[model samples]
Target: MEKHILYTTEAVNQDGLNGQSFIKTGGLTVTVSNPLNNKPGTNPEQLLGLSLSTCMNATLQAIEREHGLAHTAEVRVTVTLIKEENFAFLVVARVRIPGVPLKTATKLVALAKKRCPVSKLLSGSSYYQVQVVEDY
Candidate 1:
Protein backbone atom coordinates (compact mmCIF):
# COMPACT_ATOMS: atom_id res chain seq x y z
CA MET A 1 0.00 0.00 0.00
CA GLU A 2 1.17 3.49 -0.82
CA LYS A 3 0.79 6.39 1.55
CA HIS A 4 -0.84 9.55 0.26
CA ILE A 5 -0.32 12.44 2.60
CA LEU A 6 -3.08 15.01 2.66
CA TYR A 7 -1.55 17.60 4.96
CA THR A 8 1.38 17.99 7.28
CA THR A 9 2.54 20.55 9.83
CA GLU A 10 5.52 20.82 12.09
CA ALA A 11 5.64 22.28 15.62
CA VAL A 12 8.78 23.16 17.52
CA ASN A 13 9.14 23.35 21.26
CA GLN A 14 12.57 24.46 22.43
CA ASP A 15 11.97 24.95 26.18
CA GLY A 16 9.98 21.85 27.04
CA LEU A 17 6.93 22.79 29.18
CA ASN A 18 8.33 25.95 30.67
CA GLY A 19 8.56 28.43 27.78
CA GLN A 20 7.00 28.40 24.34
CA SER A 21 6.04 26.24 21.37
CA PHE A 22 5.53 27.44 17.86
CA ILE A 23 4.70 26.21 14.40
CA LYS A 24 7.59 25.91 12.01
CA THR A 25 5.73 27.79 9.30
CA GLY A 26 5.27 30.77 11.61
CA GLY A 27 1.47 30.89 11.90
CA LEU A 28 0.88 29.94 15.51
CA THR A 29 2.69 30.06 18.83
CA VAL A 30 1.71 29.28 22.42
CA THR A 31 3.18 29.48 25.87
CA VAL A 32 3.71 26.11 27.51
CA SER A 33 3.43 25.68 31.26
CA ASN A 34 2.75 23.17 34.00
CA PRO A 35 -0.91 22.62 34.78
CA LEU A 36 -0.25 22.49 38.52
CA ASN A 37 1.41 25.90 38.46
CA ASN A 38 -0.26 29.31 38.43
CA LYS A 39 1.49 30.27 35.18
CA PRO A 40 -0.59 31.77 32.39
CA GLY A 41 0.05 29.18 29.69
CA THR A 42 -1.32 26.01 28.20
CA ASN A 43 -0.55 22.49 29.35
CA PRO A 44 -0.30 19.13 27.58
CA GLU A 45 -3.55 17.81 29.00
CA GLN A 46 -5.55 20.76 27.72
CA LEU A 47 -3.82 20.52 24.34
CA LEU A 48 -4.65 16.83 24.08
CA GLY A 49 -8.25 17.55 24.97
CA LEU A 50 -8.43 20.22 22.27
CA SER A 51 -6.90 17.95 19.65
CA LEU A 52 -9.32 15.08 20.31
CA SER A 53 -12.37 17.31 20.55
CA THR A 54 -11.56 19.22 17.39
CA CYS A 55 -10.68 16.18 15.31
CA MET A 56 -13.66 14.15 16.49
CA ASN A 57 -16.12 16.98 15.89
CA ALA A 58 -14.72 17.70 12.46
CA THR A 59 -15.01 14.05 11.46
CA LEU A 60 -18.53 13.95 12.86
CA GLN A 61 -19.47 16.94 10.75
CA ALA A 62 -18.24 15.22 7.58
CA ILE A 63 -20.09 12.03 8.47
CA GLU A 64 -23.28 13.96 9.19
CA ARG A 65 -23.07 15.64 5.83
CA GLU A 66 -22.62 12.31 4.10
CA HIS A 67 -25.65 10.98 5.95
CA GLY A 68 -27.74 13.98 4.92
CA LEU A 69 -28.11 15.23 8.48
CA ALA A 70 -27.45 18.57 10.04
CA HIS A 71 -23.98 19.05 11.52
CA THR A 72 -25.04 19.21 15.16
CA ALA A 73 -22.52 16.95 16.76
CA GLU A 74 -20.51 18.19 19.73
CA VAL A 75 -17.46 16.55 21.24
CA ARG A 76 -15.92 17.18 24.64
CA VAL A 77 -12.66 15.64 25.71
CA THR A 78 -11.15 15.35 29.16
CA VAL A 79 -7.53 14.45 29.76
CA THR A 80 -6.24 13.62 33.21
CA LEU A 81 -2.60 13.30 34.20
CA ILE A 82 -1.85 10.49 36.67
CA LYS A 83 1.18 10.07 38.87
CA GLU A 84 1.42 6.45 39.90
CA GLU A 85 4.85 4.90 39.42
CA ASN A 86 5.41 7.20 36.48
CA PHE A 87 3.50 9.79 34.49
CA ALA A 88 0.44 8.71 32.52
CA PHE A 89 -2.60 10.27 30.92
CA LEU A 90 -6.25 9.25 30.81
CA VAL A 91 -8.28 10.48 27.87
CA VAL A 92 -12.06 10.42 27.52
CA ALA A 93 -14.01 11.77 24.57
CA ARG A 94 -17.76 12.29 24.85
CA VAL A 95 -19.92 13.09 21.85
CA ARG A 96 -23.49 14.27 21.52
CA ILE A 97 -25.52 14.73 18.33
CA PRO A 98 -28.67 16.73 18.89
CA GLY A 99 -31.94 15.78 17.15
CA VAL A 100 -30.57 12.33 16.53
CA PRO A 101 -31.56 9.19 18.38
CA LEU A 102 -29.18 7.77 20.93
CA LYS A 103 -28.64 4.61 18.93
CA THR A 104 -27.85 6.55 15.75
CA ALA A 105 -25.66 8.94 17.64
CA THR A 106 -23.74 6.05 19.09
CA LYS A 107 -23.24 4.56 15.65
CA LEU A 108 -22.02 7.87 14.32
CA VAL A 109 -19.59 8.20 17.18
CA ALA A 110 -18.33 4.70 16.53
CA LEU A 111 -17.68 5.55 12.91
CA ALA A 112 -16.01 8.79 13.88
CA LYS A 113 -13.77 6.95 16.31
CA LYS A 114 -12.74 4.64 13.52
CA ARG A 115 -12.12 7.47 11.09
CA CYS A 116 -10.61 10.32 13.07
CA PRO A 117 -6.81 10.31 12.87
CA VAL A 118 -6.24 11.27 16.48
CA SER A 119 -8.78 8.70 17.65
CA LYS A 120 -7.16 6.01 15.52
CA LEU A 121 -3.71 6.84 16.86
CA LEU A 122 -4.93 6.64 20.45
CA SER A 123 -7.21 3.65 19.94
CA GLY A 124 -4.56 1.19 20.96
CA SER A 125 -3.87 2.94 24.24
CA SER A 126 -5.65 1.53 27.28
CA TYR A 127 -6.06 5.04 28.70
CA TYR A 128 -8.07 6.31 25.74
CA GLN A 129 -11.85 6.03 25.44
CA VAL A 130 -14.60 7.43 23.23
CA GLN A 131 -18.29 7.33 24.11
CA VAL A 132 -21.60 8.75 22.98
CA VAL A 133 -23.46 10.90 25.48
CA GLU A 134 -26.80 12.61 25.39
CA ASP A 135 -25.43 15.41 27.52
CA TYR A 136 -21.86 16.50 27.96
Candidate 2:
Protein backbone atom coordinates (compact mmCIF):
# COMPACT_ATOMS: atom_id res chain seq x y z
CA MET A 1 0.00 0.00 0.00
CA GLU A 2 1.19 3.48 -0.80
CA LYS A 3 1.72 5.59 2.29
CA HIS A 4 0.68 9.22 2.47
CA ILE A 5 1.59 11.68 5.17
CA LEU A 6 -1.25 13.43 6.95
CA TYR A 7 -1.53 16.93 8.37
CA THR A 8 -3.31 18.59 11.27
CA THR A 9 -4.59 22.01 12.26
CA GLU A 10 -4.93 23.52 15.73
CA ALA A 11 -7.59 26.21 15.98
CA VAL A 12 -7.90 28.34 19.11
CA ASN A 13 -10.43 31.02 19.99
CA GLN A 14 -12.81 32.37 22.61
CA ASP A 15 -16.34 31.26 23.51
CA GLY A 16 -19.85 32.76 23.12
CA LEU A 17 -21.37 34.50 20.11
CA ASN A 18 -18.46 36.81 19.47
CA GLY A 19 -15.04 35.29 19.04
CA GLN A 20 -12.26 34.91 16.51
CA SER A 21 -11.18 31.73 14.79
CA PHE A 22 -7.70 31.96 13.37
CA ILE A 23 -5.33 29.22 12.31
CA LYS A 24 -1.61 29.71 12.29
CA THR A 25 0.64 27.41 10.34
CA GLY A 26 3.77 27.83 8.26
CA GLY A 27 3.56 31.61 8.04
CA LEU A 28 -0.01 31.41 6.88
CA THR A 29 -3.11 32.87 8.48
CA VAL A 30 -6.72 31.80 7.89
CA THR A 31 -9.64 33.55 9.49
CA VAL A 32 -13.15 32.19 9.83
CA SER A 33 -15.66 34.97 9.23
CA ASN A 34 -19.34 34.95 10.04
CA PRO A 35 -20.84 38.31 10.90
CA LEU A 36 -24.26 37.09 11.98
CA ASN A 37 -22.89 34.76 14.62
CA ASN A 38 -20.59 37.57 15.67
CA LYS A 39 -17.78 35.23 14.82
CA PRO A 40 -14.81 36.81 13.13
CA GLY A 41 -14.01 33.65 11.34
CA THR A 42 -15.21 31.52 8.50
CA ASN A 43 -17.78 29.03 9.68
CA PRO A 44 -17.97 25.38 8.67
CA GLU A 45 -20.48 26.04 5.90
CA GLN A 46 -18.31 28.65 4.25
CA LEU A 47 -15.24 26.50 4.65
CA LEU A 48 -17.00 23.63 2.95
CA GLY A 49 -17.95 25.80 0.02
CA LEU A 50 -14.39 26.99 -0.33
CA SER A 51 -12.93 23.53 -0.05
CA LEU A 52 -15.03 22.05 -2.86
CA SER A 53 -14.20 24.80 -5.30
CA THR A 54 -10.59 25.00 -4.30
CA CYS A 55 -10.12 21.33 -4.98
CA MET A 56 -12.03 21.31 -8.23
CA ASN A 57 -10.34 24.40 -9.58
CA ALA A 58 -6.90 23.25 -8.62
CA THR A 59 -7.49 20.06 -10.51
CA LEU A 60 -8.69 21.93 -13.56
CA GLN A 61 -5.70 24.22 -13.44
CA ALA A 62 -3.38 21.24 -13.35
CA ILE A 63 -5.16 19.63 -16.25
CA GLU A 64 -4.98 22.83 -18.23
CA ARG A 65 -1.24 22.99 -17.84
CA GLU A 66 -0.77 19.31 -18.57
CA HIS A 67 -3.00 19.29 -21.65
CA GLY A 68 -1.70 22.60 -23.01
CA LEU A 69 -5.27 23.89 -22.97
CA ALA A 70 -5.27 27.67 -23.05
CA HIS A 71 -8.40 28.72 -21.24
CA THR A 72 -9.29 30.21 -17.89
CA ALA A 73 -12.04 28.46 -15.95
CA GLU A 74 -14.45 30.16 -13.62
CA VAL A 75 -15.51 27.78 -10.88
CA ARG A 76 -18.45 28.40 -8.58
CA VAL A 77 -19.60 26.00 -5.91
CA THR A 78 -22.89 26.36 -4.11
CA VAL A 79 -23.63 24.58 -0.88
CA THR A 80 -27.19 24.42 0.41
CA LEU A 81 -28.60 22.90 3.56
CA ILE A 82 -32.33 22.27 3.91
CA LYS A 83 -33.40 21.37 7.41
CA GLU A 84 -36.81 20.10 6.36
CA GLU A 85 -35.43 17.82 3.67
CA ASN A 86 -33.76 14.48 4.25
CA PHE A 87 -30.57 15.58 2.55
CA ALA A 88 -28.66 18.02 4.70
CA PHE A 89 -26.10 19.57 2.35
CA LEU A 90 -25.97 19.66 -1.40
CA VAL A 91 -22.90 20.95 -3.25
CA VAL A 92 -23.26 22.03 -6.84
CA ALA A 93 -19.98 22.75 -8.62
CA ARG A 94 -20.16 24.68 -11.87
CA VAL A 95 -17.22 25.37 -14.12
CA ARG A 96 -17.16 27.91 -16.93
CA ILE A 97 -14.29 27.15 -19.27
CA PRO A 98 -13.93 29.66 -22.05
CA GLY A 99 -12.78 28.50 -25.51
CA VAL A 100 -13.18 24.88 -24.52
CA PRO A 101 -15.72 22.73 -26.23
CA LEU A 102 -18.72 21.75 -24.17
CA LYS A 103 -18.04 18.04 -24.54
CA THR A 104 -14.38 18.42 -23.63
CA ALA A 105 -15.24 20.60 -20.64
CA THR A 106 -17.65 17.98 -19.39
CA LYS A 107 -15.01 15.29 -19.62
CA LEU A 108 -12.44 17.43 -17.83
CA VAL A 109 -14.92 18.23 -15.10
CA ALA A 110 -15.54 14.53 -14.55
CA LEU A 111 -11.84 13.82 -14.34
CA ALA A 112 -11.25 16.73 -12.00
CA LYS A 113 -14.07 15.54 -9.74
CA LYS A 114 -12.28 12.23 -9.37
CA ARG A 115 -8.87 13.79 -8.77
CA CYS A 116 -9.59 16.77 -6.52
CA PRO A 117 -8.55 16.16 -2.93
CA VAL A 118 -11.51 17.99 -1.40
CA SER A 119 -13.83 16.14 -3.72
CA LYS A 120 -12.33 12.85 -2.62
CA LEU A 121 -12.62 13.82 1.02
CA LEU A 122 -16.23 14.88 0.58
CA SER A 123 -16.86 11.63 -1.26
CA GLY A 124 -15.54 9.67 1.77
CA SER A 125 -12.42 8.36 0.02
CA SER A 126 -10.13 10.17 2.47
CA TYR A 127 -10.53 10.52 6.24
CA TYR A 128 -8.97 12.35 9.12
CA GLN A 129 -6.78 10.57 11.64
CA VAL A 130 -6.94 12.20 15.02
CA GLN A 131 -4.57 11.44 17.86
CA VAL A 132 -4.57 13.04 21.26
CA VAL A 133 -1.46 12.91 23.40
CA GLU A 134 -1.67 13.63 27.12
CA ASP A 135 0.59 16.34 28.44
CA TYR A 136 0.66 16.30 32.18
Candidate 1, residue 70: the lDDT equals 95
Kindly list the per-residue Cα lDDT of model 1 for residues 12-67, writing each as its tens digit: 99899999999998897999999988999998899889999999999999999999
Q: Which clashing pairs does model 2 show?
A: 32-41, 32-42, 33-41, 33-42
Say which candidate scores most in TM-score.
1
Candidate 2 stretches with Cα past 4 Å from truth are 6-8, 11-18, 24-41, 85-87, 124-136
TM-score of 2: 0.69
In terms of lDDT, model 2 sits at 0.65
How much is the lDDT of residue 33 in candidate 2?
55
Per-model TM-score versus the true fold: 0.97, 0.69
Count the clashes in each prediction.
0, 4
- In model 1, the clashing pairs are none
Residue-wise C-alpha lDDT for candidate 2, range 8-121, written one tens digit per residue: 777556643244555655443456554345646656566677877777788889988788987576677776655654635666677877777777777777777778877777
Overlapping backbone residue pairs in candidate 1 total 0
Off by over 4 Å in 1: none
